[model samples]
Target: MVNTRTTDYWSQFIVDYSGGGDFFIANAYGKSAAQLSYDRVLFGSALQVVENIKLINNIIVVDLPVSAFQGLSLSPDDRAFYQVIADNQHLTGYEDLSSAFRPKKRIRRVDGPYEAEYFDGVYSAEKVRFIKLSRKLIEGELQVGVVVYLAQTLQSRNEMAHDISVKALQLVSVIFTIALSVCYVFIWFIVRPIRRLNTVLSERAPTDLTPIDTDAPKEISELLRTINHFMMQLQNTLDRLKHFTSETAHQVRTPLAGILAQSQNALMENDKPKRHSQITQVIDSCESLSRTVDQLLNQALLAHRFKSKALEKVWLGALIKEVSRDQVLTALQQKVELAYIGPNDDCQIVGDTVALKKMLQNIIENAIKYSPKQGVVEITLIIEKNREINDIRPRYGHS
Candidate 1:
């Protein structure tokens, strides 16, 4: 038996006597091989195997011609490695030895960073060689076989390593597949939520400019915020345009009605004295239409000027008073009152002065037209925490 810490040399001795294990019940004898005084026992099975086995220098040796080796080409280095194996005696020293084999100090291989395997097993192709013993049973019942030690080589070890590497790579392939599955599922978790968020944003209600609650995953929040800001501006611009259009419609339609009325009345009159008055009425109606069109044009032009953003500091009270005074003649003709209610003291404000002047003209003219004769049109200015529109009211339309 081979001990856990020691391979039995007695195991080799048993081969010289033609046996596998050192112990056996003798078929018809007084003792077993285990009880024998010598390490080896001569058996009837030995004679049958004796001729088939080869021994040289008391070292057992064997050579096998393999069909697989015959078909392959050998490198010069590998050829040299095989020659060293055939010439090596240390591996075959057991064949000629008369005395029982002794346990050897293990040999270390200098060239191998690779693993070395020793085979003392029965019928191992690379290590032990077995042969038939006379094709016959021996000692009335014992079956016999030949055993020998073969040479070792770097080439042989290389072949085994290649096979083992292939098996290891196959195991790694399985692990790689499992890892890919995990990654695919993780990415799916990420894309699914993003797709859902995209659907929600694109499908938003048309009437609702309310900011979308994207619940964005840290990554897209800044984009969502920008989208929301744009939506707010768009909503505000649309509202302003709607109100402007309604006001413009009202302003334009009134003059058109007056012109229609004047023309009809003039057409009905035959006297030259009455004809002159009707023509004057038509002329006045045309003037009102012209002023409304001019104001609208000025508003458009001023809006273009505002884009330059050259808002300079100008005196607010003076700016308003200048525009109102210029239009006082028109106000008087309409039998409406015009006045500045603000502090006559200088109050400087930051704005485009030209645009502000135009704004005041439009506002003041609106007040004069809507107010009754002797109505008080007061423009009050306050220099306070901020510019307060409440401090002044054009009593014409907004009573």
Candidate 2:
């Protein structure tokens, strides 16, 4: 019965023996036959272990001092073989089966005392990793030792890794395709509302300024609201322009008709003084027509200013005085006295100057038109605390 300590010692001894064999092979390089012979003799005691194993029918029999070799207990597929050669000639070696062996590729030379190769075994017809240690011993003399291992586990691991890589690649491709499809759907939903808006605007008539009615996302809805506001403003401007055109035509027609009638009357009058009075009436009508035309033009200009011009600081008192001065000639022609009553201090307001001037002119002109002959048309600018008021009135003048 071999003890545990004895089994361990023999196991270590086997490992040391294998390593020593590689060392011996490498050191044997560049040695003549006589030198090799002499070295082997010197190492005869260490080499005796291998010879003794051979004498025991390649089996390690342990009773008290020896332990059975553990390799003999391994399955045939896991078993390893060892061999030795000298001068490219077989020296001493053994295999379970008779077969030819040749090294197919040099694998690597380990940093230790050994080299290794890989090959296929003709007897088993299987791939194997063959570890070797070799040396050139003098001219035409070489010696080597090799240990061969079956590569079944390595081949199985390689196949498994290839399968895993293929599966991972397939999973990645599937995920990318699904993500692309989702993005395409999302973009389509976003673009659909914009396309609808385009179609509605493109197909409408040029004169159409009606608000658009459509359902959309919140952002697009805000854009639609802005567009609708612009359209409403455009519609109001068009309506105002139409009304102004109609009013201008009516106003002009009245003055023209009056002038024509007065001229015809003057042509028929036999009295010179009466005919001269009729001619004066025609001239007054023409002047009134001219004033009306000017007012219409001013109104049009004010409309444009309202759209395009921003409010500015205006001197209200000065503007009122200027308007009154401009209307003095018209008031005199009508035999109406124009008077301005206001504080001398300048009053300021934020307003459009053109619009304010036109408004004041309209008030004064209307006052003078309605006043009787020898009437006074008074324009007063009253400055109160925190407010300013413009007043226009007509009063009868003393004869």
lDDT of 2 by residue, 1-399 (tens): 769778556544533353544324422331233233322221232122233322123332212112122322232333334444433444444443224445555445342343333334443454433334443322223223222222221233233333333344345447768999999999999999999999999999999999998888986898999999999999999999999999999999999999999999999999999999999999999999998999898989998999989999999889989988899999999999988766678888899998998888888888888888988877677667867554434333533
| lDDT: worst 10-residue window of model 2 | 60-69
- Per-prediction TM-score to the true structure, in the order listed: 0.38, 0.48
Give the per-residue lDDT of model 1 (tens digit) for 1-399. 648334234323332343322222122121222222111111122222233334455444444334313322232223211211122232333343212212243222221222221222222133321111122213434433333222222343343343333333444446667989999998887677678877987787876787777577666677778878988977876776677788789989998898898788889889888988988988988998898888877876686578547888887777777887898898889877777776757677778887888877878888887787766677667666665333444555322
Q: Which stretches of candidate 2 lie over 4 Å from their true place?
A: 1-185, 258-278, 328-341, 366-379, 388-399
Pick by TM-score: which candidate is best? 2
Candidate 1 TM-score, C-alpha based? 0.38
Q: How far is candidate 2 from the true structure (C-alpha RMSD, Å)?
A: 20.5
CA error at residue 2 for candidate 2, angstroms: 61
TM-score of predicted structure 2: 0.48
